[model samples]
Target: MSVDRFCETMCIATIAVMFGCVACITIKTPVGAISGIQETLTVDGRPYRMSTFLGIPFAESTAGENRFKKPITKAPFLSTFDATKNPMACFPSHLGGEIKYGKYVNFSEDCLNLNVFVPHSFEKNVSLPVMIWIYGGSFVEGATAIFPGEGISAFGDVIVVTVSYRLGMFGFIQSADGKLPGNLGLWDQHLGIKWVHDNIQAFTGNPNDVTVFGESAGGASVIFQSLYPGNRGFFQRVIAQSGSALAYWAVHATPNAEPLIAKKGCERAPDPVKCLRALTPRQLQDDDTSAWQPVIDRDFLLASPQEIIFGNSSHTQNARNFFASLDLMTGANNFDGAVYFRDVWPFIFKTTDMNTFNLTRGQFTGIAIPSIIADAIKPKNHNIASIMGKLLDFEYTDWQLPNDSATLLFSLTNMSNDVGFFYPVVSTVKGHSSLRKGKTYLYELSAVPTTHTLQTPNWIQGSNHADDIQYVFGYPLYAGPRSTGNYTEEERRLARGMVTMWTNFAKSGDPNQPEDARRFTNATWAEYDLNSQSFLHFTNQGALPGSRFEARRMQLWLDLIPTIALMETPQAHGTGTVHVPEIIIGK
Candidate 1:
């Protein structure tokens, strides 16, 4: 039974015992607090109250004139607010699909409200660590209410906050005229963090111990926030899963390119906004315009993460402190590259049209591909076989494409992919090593596990994109889709190990607690350093000590300089560390 139901039963039993008659007792929350009609539940054996306040405005809804503009915080709300119902999602079709998932609910433009979960007996003085999650749908399609925990209040042990912000075009659109603003979604995160910082103490969470975490796009956002000048102290630590600074869809303008096509589709509409607003959510989904993403605003993203890490950018102000105060933990699922490489091969395969493919085959061969491979493999000190073995595995069967096809494709794909995903991660790990030596952790998901499903009895495979989400959020195993049959029994065990590691990290900067080893042999997690590059390797049994992943390949890729230059501000150089490119030539 849920905690609320259990509490109600006990309350009724208490009344019957005291009065010698069964009676209904009025259970109200503590005065002046965000109240819920729902009864409180016990957390760690302590009575904890929970509440969800729907539609507490965070910004002017991004509809009509407000479209493409930064969000404005709502004026203070008056009167008691009841958070009993699920609020509307941030303006529907932000992700271009209606009921994308059968359960995907639609929300609104004025969707600035947040859900607050607090334990009933939470004392004002006992400061709990806070975890703020930024849900990912490639920068779209997430609402504050849809996450697994039911509401922010469900996390009785720790103060958890989930935000509802604009997504896709409504959140991250940019106009060529420089008229349309970018990253409204990012601004919403800033506002949300600020809100938590100002008010979480009332919920018994420590603002100083805040750790921002997310999966996929949300993971990328956490990395982005780590490097954003305006975001310091808003969060002290970050946990990123799946999405990375090196991924192709992440760094290139491709995320926005599709919308240009959408703009073309919208150009013919009688009224752009009205047509977009009026179309059946499905029709808008068909328009293909919703892929808008966060771009460098010169204000929030002073430079792309590449320039910051390579220490090659000229712009400095508002950027110097980007990595100055961050403590980080990040990793990728084993098969993240599976779905990742599939998505980009077509671009490389159809490179004849620069308008469509962007880079020519020769450009890919002589410059782009080579540059990327060099950076990814860091071939200077290693042989081609050694570099390829660790960083990439080619197959002669279904996995291998004849001749140089696979090699070229892999290089092109991983080039941008590494920069977008791994590079930022490496940079973050390294930065923490230099700046916060005692407090950084990195992990790699290696195990796959079996799970039961309605259609099949058991299906399992290695970790794929977003696979780590359930573990990190402590969401129930049966909540969403199950894994494939190929996944090992050990993968499930690793998932539990991951949860403990994350919660432990959330409570304190260190990922391993004193008792972690009791649960699994790999309980001892070492802080990352350049020499050890220590990282927790997730396997069937649990996590184990690991280092040296594609070392030669990674080294080779570090030799070449990044082609795209970093954006510059006036005060300081935005570069945090020098990122040299290295390459590996596949034999």
Candidate 2:
């Protein structure tokens, strides 16, 4: 039989068997009654039973008039809803590619749904901690089917819910006159959280004890959600991995939507939103315009995320206080920049083979470093950009081997790591820990996987972006035949340790507390503070506590660079050395 026929036959057979017996599990949520599938999964050579409910809608269809507007909460189900399979993914920014689980998802405009996974052990009156996952695709592309929560729910002993929101222009499009305020995607997430907080009890989850966690853009999205003034009590704790609201790529203050509107023949229309809505999703998604990202629309975001987090103005004090009230865990991979650099290499360096790309010092300072600063920082003025570029070139360069191609490659990779991932993540941690009201923990994943999923230059070592995801989700313990890669014994142990710690943090306010501390190499995760600058370092051998991660380099980006950028004027460039002043945090 063909693959489609085989799949259809197996699906019909499975349904027949389920109907023949009392195998299906039904739970009555606030919306209505829904049925899910119960399956047995093996983790660490032990069998566990869990129930999975997929494709549960949280909001109404976001097609036509609702395209660029806030999502309306999904009404109660008229009858029993069969939520056994994954929902169609939101219209992706790009066309034709498999998402996380090697599944080619169908696209739809009405794709605001969520999936719930519950362990059979805690499917009754017991109240278990809940974890809501948001996938990251730079706010342009992502699907709920990517990261399945079966392993997390079964092994971590917490109820897991993965949410799906709108993507690309359909999710974020704005007008100068505020006709289409951006961040409709964010509003969709807010409604999903609210739905869970209101109705998770049916799945034996504690709404009060909930943790919102995500990686990459999802990580940034969680941080953005925490900063939103209206989400004061939506979730109690947050975990952001390799992404931050302060990251330059995460937020676009003033995105130009006119090009896309004009491309769709809507420029002449008095109401661009309506005109664009009239076109099919394919018509809009096929345009060559840049992907739509989050913006400061005064509704979802009152101002810049950085300003709201660290600013001392009286108006921002309440936002800071609310942000500080929630427990936060944020961190980045050691070589997070390698993945980003690899993607942008051909465009900037004019080469795909980075290993053979011999870079010169002149080109490094003139073409390479300047391009990175301009792209990442998006400095307003030429003078500011020029000053920042010179400062970075001086800081990132290896004086001893300045002319070596390999050394230049390494330096460029580190520069990307710092300005993009490390600086933003550390800055967010600093702002949160500075308040001292909420418990905060930081980490760095340096453990290299034996089997590499992402291709990087041999010179670049350490964990790349999203490398920590598999271990966190316990992929090794439950990877099936169609899984991407196989895991060794060491990887299995690492997965166990990571899942234990991640779930522990969700249960209580601490990762090392409430038992299973010894599973994570028996290392106590120290709470991050300005004094020690402590963080948990995950290595190949085991988890170890470290202090002042890349102290000198961090000082360069956080303290020295900002200070120089502030003092240097247009005429100061190439004139003489500029004196850098001390910057006190929270002053």
Candidate 3:
């Protein structure tokens, strides 16, 4: 070989070696043997730590005989599996699956797992508070080891855990024959929370002081856990961002409402249990996408959260404890329902514009006639147009959808937030006030900066739905957090403020001390009252009080549809097809 060639080869080898070292160092953590892309850092002058534990099993795969059954806990972490590398997210679909910005992560049906982060060297006995985050993808899609979750773990000194639950048909499946039931997805979450409550202490967390927090579907989970009888005592405090139980797709407004129909508008299959189990995951996903929801199985979920909220259920404690006793905080991002509206508009209406994706008044009253009523009467009718039309007025059913699809879309988007997200939370607050459990604080965020990545077309600014997630977790965005060109300082402050408030709330019941009672300068957070419903408004200027901030919009929802809110123990709601424990023969 020529001398010149030898030198070039040697140099190339040397650079490759150097690059390998950088990758190793970046992926490995500085602490003990725990794995999965660990990072060491500090928070509040305390040594903080973060790591992603991809695909740690929380439940056995719900395939074959296991289908539709409650989640079965996995044995302790095995030494054979490397906890260090991000596992393929459990199957059928990956996290952020099919989204434009989707990242490639390993996904599988065996993907019931969670990620955890903790501060380094907190006095061993300190027993720092633990925050378990449930990601929101309308309960159909999302993963624990996502971007913002990792960032949020970095923002706090407390132990942070993000979980991945089963989604779509794999998670929720209502039986046509009433032999097989639904809500297995929610039960999976309950099992995971039970795992946390039982095992978080081993990881140096205060199991008793745990706070369950989530956005969108996740936010909905927090409300569910609080109200679901099976989930009582799982977490002490709750934080729900952008979704609620008293909203649409939650539960029906009236009691003894029709049963949630099965896939393809079928009420019951010939061999409901065996037939559903026989279908492939893809078959279920495609067939069951229309009404993926948590059901009020008298066993697991005694009464509907709606019934509990209205104080009309036999399980009064379910309502009382969820809304009244616990320290709870819930809010919605302004753009919470835009994506749904955008997607559903075209499917429901005949003349929707592909380019603009807006619905017309004529389309609303005509082709869209079934869409409105169909949505208004969910589960029971699912995709059955005839059944939904029977429940609501043909005129009121279609009504004049807003002239601009944006206007109607905005209303519909917020409807879920108002009815499903905000109203249930307020009802819980009001219920709590009646019970005299503790003070309930309400807030609304309305800062629309031009900086953050403007993913939605409606507006380049304004607090679109799920915007709070970016700020709450302090995740880096494409546009940064502001258009002011000041970079991420304000965003960082907001993140810090949120984390601090959340952690404090987890540690104690109250998020605010006497001195730091309000969320921010522009707002003096107020306890919710039935007569004077209000919320602390968060904007660039500061936080202040706003009356009936989200309630008025949702009130019309009550006018339009009836509902049932359940808030008591399982045994109380009578026989509404709840999941009850069967006798264990040998065990």
Error of 1 at 346 (Å): 8.7
Weakest ten-residue segment in model 3 by summed lDDT? 578-587
Per-residue CA lDDT of model 1 for 26-117, tens digit only, reads: 22322222433234443223443443334445555666566557777665544343344455677544343345533545455567767655
Q: All candidates' TM-scores?
A: 0.71, 0.91, 0.74
Q: Please provide, for model 2 over 80-199, each residue's C-alpha lDDT reduced to its tens digit, 9 standing for 90 to 100.
A: 677776677898765632244236467788899999988883445789999999988777787888787877778889999999998878787777878878899999999999999988
Off by over 4 Å in 2: 1-22, 96-102, 121-123, 286-291, 480-482, 568-587
- Per-residue C-alpha lDDT of model 3 across residues 371-477, encoded as one tens digit per residue: 54445433343344453343333323224534666554444455434534455556555555566665566667676644543245454246766777766664432
**What local lDDT score does residue 334 receive in model 2, on the 0 to 100 scale?**
92
TM-score of 2: 0.91
Cα deviation in Å at residue 121, candidate 3?
5.3
- For each candidate, the alpha-carbon lDDT, in order, equals 0.55, 0.79, 0.56
lDDT of 3 at 404: 66
The local distance difference test score of model 2 is 0.79
Ranking 1 against 3 by TM-score, winner: 3
Residue 425's lDDT within candidate 2 is 91
lDDT measured at residue 517 in model 1 versus the true structure, 0 to 100: 41
**Least lDDT summed over 10 consecutive residues: which range in candidate 1?**
451-460
